[model samples]
Target: MSRRSLLSRAIRSNGEPIKITIDKSGANTSAINDYNDDAGADIEIRQNKYLNNIIGQDHRPIKQLCKATLGFGRFRTARITIGDFESMRIIRKR
Candidate 1:
């Protein structure tokens, strides 16, 4: 494949569920650099902290879309169809 076609395919979104795994045990401690400095620390993954970070990152855009749908009639009146995975497929005829 050409470089341009390869890049275009890579950039396309294939709508997939993201999975995250966290180990509560300290067995898999990953080292993270505190700063650009050489100093580093090993930290275990905490479920609550991971969940909070995931929620913070993922929920904002969804909430904004919902808000826009409510605020704008054009967005609100979209023809919404529920697909196989319960994913909403919206089509705007306008």
Candidate 2:
């Protein structure tokens, strides 16, 4: 689960992003810089905590629920479970 591998996997799955907003983590900044240099992609990185708050807030419930379960056995299972949880949350909101 190195940062580069994670970033590459995300890009591979979701396609390249035009910009990315992240916290002020040097490792993440370095990884993005390296990725841009190696791949010749210009993906802007913004390190503002305020911009990331919405994402953090939205995941709080999922994190709480998963924390109780001690995590899923596989990535697919986690993805599916979280997807279901998010769907239900959205439905409840409407």
Assess every candidate by TM-score: 0.24, 0.74
Model-by-model lDDT, in order? 0.38, 0.93
Clashes per candidate, residues 3 or more apart or on different chains: 0, 0
- Residue 33 lDDT, candidate 1, scale 0-100: 17
Clashing pairs in 2: none
Candidate of highest lDDT: 2
Q: Show model 1 residue runs off by greater than 4 Å.
A: 1-46, 71-94
Model 2 is weakest, by summed lDDT over 10 consecutive residues, at 54-63
